[model samples]
Target chain A: MNRHILSVLVENQSGVLSRISGLFSRRGYNIDSLAVGETEDPTVSRMTIVVQGDDYILEQIKKQLNKLIDVIKIISLAPNVSVFRELVLVKVSATEKNRASITEIVSIFRASIIDVSNSTLTVELTGDQEKIQAFLELMRPYGIKELVRTGLSALQRGDTQISQTVTE
Target chain B: MKAADAIVKCLQKENVEIVFGYPGGAVLPLYESLRSSSIKHILVRQEQAAVHSASGYARSLGRVGVAIGTSGPGATNLITGIATAYMDSIPMVVFTGQVSTELMGRDVFQEVDITGATEPFIKHSYLVKDATQIPRIIKEAFHLASTGRPGPVLIDVPKDVQNDRLDYVYPQDVSIRGYKPTVQGHMGQIKRAIRKLRNSKRPLICVGGGILRSKAQEELANFVTKAKIPVVHTLMGIGALPVDHPYYFGMVGSHGFAHANRAVSQSDLLVVIGARVADRATAGPGLFAKNAEIIHIDIDPAEIGKNLGTLIPTVGDAKNILQQLIKGITSLATDQWVQNLREIKDSQKDVLFEDRVGVNPKVILKTLGGILEDTAIVTADVGQNQIWAARNFPVTGKRQLLTSGGLGTMGYSLPAAVGAKIACPDYQVVAVVGDGGFQMSMFELGTMAQNGLPLVILLFNNSRLGMVRELQNDGYGECFGIDLTGNPDFIKLVGAYGFSGIRVHNDDQFADAMKTGLAATKPFLVECIVDPKESTL
Candidate 1:
């Protein structure tokens, strides 16, 4: 199986999210990650979905997604042609002894400590999947108390916009 | 003007002549509005039958069927009918009353989130929060239900919204940015399909209900005759081609004919039109047409490669795609292939159960097929009766067989027949149902009587859910809850509804009973005793 990123534009309606998620579960397709937010146009919303499947399964997913009446357009974002980022907040257990080392590692990764107490430091990081994974690995020695992530949100690298493209 | 009156005005704007519904507390306001309107209303015994009847109306006339019900249980009851229409792509617009907006989430009396409940099956739905949007919403609902790959759309109106004041102005046209359906096939794909058909030595065309849904039967016939391809159909595709057509093979599936299934397996190339190649039609997807190249044409792109692998995929209306194919096609040299299929079809003997106790259901259906007019409409309920009608009933001229093929809802035929009779009063409408399924919606007999519909109800009594029993006997080696031992005397039941009926015990009695039933001016029931051990092959 291969991982694929789908950028979709849908009508910004109350139950649009449920319709998209319901379709995935009903069709037995697995969603690895999903992030949705209002688009530039208030009437439309953009959904970034990450799914893992073979070519046939991916094609079926795309076709099925297109069938939903609220869904306006769907574009597959290839890794090389798209910019992907995820924002993660990690609360690491910190003592006075290891505080300097944690700060050093945060600086090295260009991540910032957004919140801090004597026992723990909360770091906020935004980067590609690989960068975030590496930072999390380096912070493993300090012990992560709590963590939350906004799943991968993506955009095409070129001037072409998903909303502007004419869907076939 | 009141919002409820505006809703009625919107229906009028859509040219909806009739609606099927059962009124309840939540929809009282809308019912009041309908009371003074010119459009006719059918009060079904149950809310489920309302939707089924509407489906029958829609399928028979190629129009968007309209049905209404109240909130909570009323809306819940329409779920099966909605799913049935969705599965078969029947065009329908359904209305459900909602609890007052304030009481929606409080678990008040008669409150249910119907739009949420039906999201998976409905084509589109709206939970109306603004009364001022009623005219626009109703217009959009009709457009969504009848356009593109047609299916059911729903509108849920709270009682307060129904009574709220609003200026009525129905939209003249619909333009939804997210919902444009392809009406014309891609030229390149059409050419590729034509090339594939021309190159193949043995080509077969498999059509489904989409042909009827798109009103493409004539186009399909012209294409078949021009291309010299043998045709087969799914159960829902029964009326797409005349049963006596020389190039037409029988229905194809597990319950389908052996010769038809063989034709599917042996063909070198398959052109599947308007069908999703569902599991019931393919029997087993992996082995279906394993050696054949496929060309799939459907309005919905999702159905193209979902089941069978397609070498050429054409996305458009079936009628439009078939028209394009006809325009580009030259005659194929498939005389030898057609001859081989004809020989195979001719050599196969009709499977019979001579030792069984009662009259064979297949023989009864065949006799009824012969007795009925060429333009008759036969609605068969799910199970053995459905298979019997689909296989044995000869569909010629404008004859149609309406069944709940996808969801296989048992009580569909009786109410659907009611709808068909209402849609085409001059045409003969018959409801072919098994004993197990007959009791499911027999209450609709009152609806028939109230409307003075002259319908012929052909009831096959086997004292069991024959299909389930057959499965148990073949697969599990034991039967459990298939028996309907306490089934009522169907003739007397009809008599109570102010209708006349007859009981047929053998083959010789069926033709005469059918003739008598057809000759009667009132609703007539002909109950045929079927053998308990008779199997659907």
Candidate 2:
């Protein structure tokens, strides 16, 4: 199995998000992560979706995406050639016993302590999948209370733009 | 300007002459505007017929047909008809009146989320919230439904939205953000396909319904004449060429002819145009044309490599690609291949239909074929009789055969023919239906009677759902739900509705009944007894 991060450009139309997600479920394909936001052009939106499937599954998804009139274009960015990132807010228990250790761990991972309270510390981390996972593992022993991670969004490393050349 | 008036104006801009629809309380404002509009609205007996008639109109006229229905059950009833058009890729624009904007989600009277409900079947759907957006939405709906791989697009206009006033400014040309369809095949792909055809010793052209939809019949004929390839028709593709054309090798697959099936199986190279290689046409990909290098040409890019893989896929409009192919190809001697297939075709003939002890549908179709005009449009229902019509019905010239081929809709014929005759009043229109299938939507006869639309309805009485019985015979060893021995007297049923009709059990009376019916000013119905045991071709 290979991990594919597909950057999809779609028309900013009502119920388009539901339609795309419905397609995944209808085709029996699993979506690991997905993030959608309005692009620079108000009429269009970009979707960053991460999926883990075989080559056949990837091919099927790509073909299905093109079939949706709302979907304009899709670029499957390779991990090695792309810059991938995810924002994660990990709130860990910060009792007197483990306060110092938690701060050291946060500094080591280059994560900022966004919220600090009497009982917990909410660490905001933004990086690739590996960096987010590593930060969460070290904070796990402190009796982590809550966690929320944004779905992956990626861009090509070089200055090869996607917007201007996307339209037919 | 009133939003409802603007909507009508937009339809007029699209050159829609008639609309098959039913007016209800929620849709009063639109009807109020339509009262004075030049666009003729045919009030159908039911919402289902409205859509079916639109489909029949689209099929015969090669134009985007329009259907309208009120919200809730009225809109819900149009689901099957919309789905039928979607499955067949027929171009249609369906407008369903919605509840007032405020009562949309409050579950007020006659409120339904039509856009959400028909998402799968609809090519595109819009829930109109603002009155000002009507012109753009209507224009876009027309553009989407009639372009590329044509299908049904729907717009749900809320009653309150229609009542609201706005300055109507219809766009000069639509500019959809992300919906451009490829209209021309890549030249490289076309060249590659031509090279393959030139090399293959046994080449076959598999024709589908898209040719007729694209108005590519002349180009297909031109291509075939130069290529000298034997063409096989899928059920929906029957009218692509004359049924009696020397190169035409009948329909293919499950109920397909033995020789036609053999022709596909034995061919070394298959050039499939317009036809999606459906399971009914191919049986299964593995067994179907196992040795053939398949070249699939289609207008829909989505359909390419779908269901069955192809060696070379050429995507574009059927007419454009066919025209290109005609210019690129050089005629080769397929004398041996044609001779061999003709021998097999001759040997395999008359095996599917035999003159049985009872009233065989084969003889009925044969006799009917001899009687009907070359320019008569026959709307056929789904049953065992459908297969018989598909095989034996002499589809000649411009007169088309319209059916719920994709949806396999049982009660489709009568209502659709009403739409067809209304659209093309000059042409002779007929509805060929089975007894069990006839009863499903037979009430549409009242609509025909009320409007005084002259139509010839040929009802084949088998006293059962013929296809289901055939399936039961093949798999279960006996029939259950398929049998309907206590069917109502069909002729009397139509007669009570004020139609001049007859019930016949033989050819002589059948001919006389048809002749008399055709001569009448009122809608005519002829019910003929058919053998239930005989298998459909």
Candidate 3:
């Protein structure tokens, strides 16, 4: 099944995030990406979780999550129509011989090499999950050593917003 | 008059009595001013407790709760409490003394940007640069914090501002640029919802916490009766309709009544009011009203079609909306549909009732129900205590049951009970908490003792995190790290806090303890040691 993006509003309290993630993990559901950040309202935080399931299991997970003490609301953004992105910093070893090829690859992907030393080069990339994954696979052959990827952060494509609905 | 006088006057304007907090260097001036002021200051062990206490005070009183702390560590400690209150939509105002304005942003001694740190968690935060603004800011803070969807607001006062002199004038009214809250229902949406309800055969009303917040119980009851629709309540919607009312179909959700869940699943037209259609309440969106054309009526427009995917989405106040709906409902009848719901309700009425010794949680709750008047509002925490109250406590009147259903805050019961007691002083309020949760805000006993608000606290001592243990048994296949080894003696704990305390070992003892505790003209704690293995949910 295609992954769906869900934004959850939860009480910003201890053990709330853990409880939600625990429920997902315990249910044997694999999460593609999950990112949490404070919303415009301090009392509530927005959790964007990328989960792959049909309408049934996704709704089931959402319902179980609502049973948590800190959870306030949940909304699933329309897939394909939504805009999603993830930030990644990857470290790879490059030499003078392959440096031009790596640079060419980096330019092709529109990624920037943030750090460069004699033995190691660090490239920072920001894009959708698929685009980042494609670049990572190409870098794999060039002795990819370490990678740090930020979980997916998403917003709906158009004027549709979470806060607008809650405000009224 | 000094700037301290201005600050004190601002507090008076807000009608702040008790502030839960620990004192420190940056706030010494405010603490000094507090000494001369009539406002009672509660000395909490930690700044976190101060916020939680303030949350409790707010939830119990319907007034904006106040808490204070010093800058740096003090402000950081209050983060959790503020976050907790923010999440639960409780109104609270937190005051943190900052380093002198001159030294701000330089990371001077005990200087932290409290306003910046708290920016993410507070509804709004102000870093006071002028003494004259203190009164207006304090007034506005309370206004902003308590009004609209109530939340925590922070005022970071620099030491200099606290000590600066200003001509104090308290504003009688508050005005803000973009904070107007809609108070009434939209007539157009109400008419549409009413029209849909009148035509539908299998209509079910799903209620949420918004009903309680709006004080629309009578309106909800009237609409249900006039429309002849059965109600299925969410956990937070508990007391919106009397639990035993003939039209009441029971609670809906994961732990909801079987019939209520089935009714929601089987209904052809769902009339959701004041509810967010939370995942638990719907048992997953796919199963909730899949066959029904949903009519969502909520004050928060975001809640409409946010979860269950509705056709008729109405956004407005519950009471106002219900009133409008009633006006539009033209003598509609679906008697056979109502009877079908009743039959379903009757069929799934069996919950496992274990009769045993040593004061079972259910028995204690039932007994408490018998002793208290029907008007008493019972606030229950999560875990065994919540389940016990849900299964055994009977809510007979309006605005009687208040709990943290969506967030299910474990330490929520005691604080919320305090708020409910303050809101309706004539009605008896009891906080039913398990041992694990009781320890979270146990210090609130001091608040009760100091305020002279008598409350009956039923502490179900299971010597474990009973709910987690149950989960472990069912899901993990074993119990580990859930049992309590050194549970606090609740009686001694209450006694230490200068309140009356009693221990109940048996059925007869529980009754006597409850009587003795309720008879005392002070707050009382009744500690009943419940068996660890038993769970109602």
Best candidate (score: lDDT)? 1
Model 3, B283-395: lDDT tens digits are 67567888899988775554555577788877677888888877777655778877887787777744464664467676677788778886777788888788778767877
How well does each candidate reproduce the native contacts, as fnat? 0.79, 0.34, 0.00
Candidate 2 on B6-48: residue-level lDDT in tens?
9999999999999999999888999999999999988888899
Q: After superposing candidate 1, which stretches have Cα over 4 Å from the reference?
A: A166-168
TM-score between predicted and true chain B, model 3: 0.90
- Per-residue CA lDDT of model 1 for B1-537, tens digit only, reads 999999999999999999999999999999999999999999999999999999999999999999999999999999999999999899999999999998889999989999999999999999999999988888888888988899999999999999999877777888888889988999999999999999999999999998999999999999999989999999988899999887899999988999999999999999999888788988776778887999999999898888998899889999998999999999999999999999999999977668987788888888887888989999999999999899999999999999999999999999999999999999999999998888999889999999999999999999999999999999999999998988888889999999999999899988988998898899999998888899887
Q: Is candidate 2 or candidate 3 better by TM-score?
A: 2
- List, for all models, the DockQ compared with the true complex: 0.85, 0.54, 0.05
Q: Deviation in angstroms for B238 in model 2?
A: 1.1
Best by DockQ: 1
Worst 10 residues of 2 chain B by lDDT: B351-360
Docking class of 2: medium
DockQ computed for model 3 against the true two-chain complex using alpha carbons = 0.05
When candidate 1 is compared with the true two-chain complex, its DockQ is 0.85
DockQ for candidate 2 = 0.54
Q: What is the lDDT of residue A125 in candidate 3?
A: 95
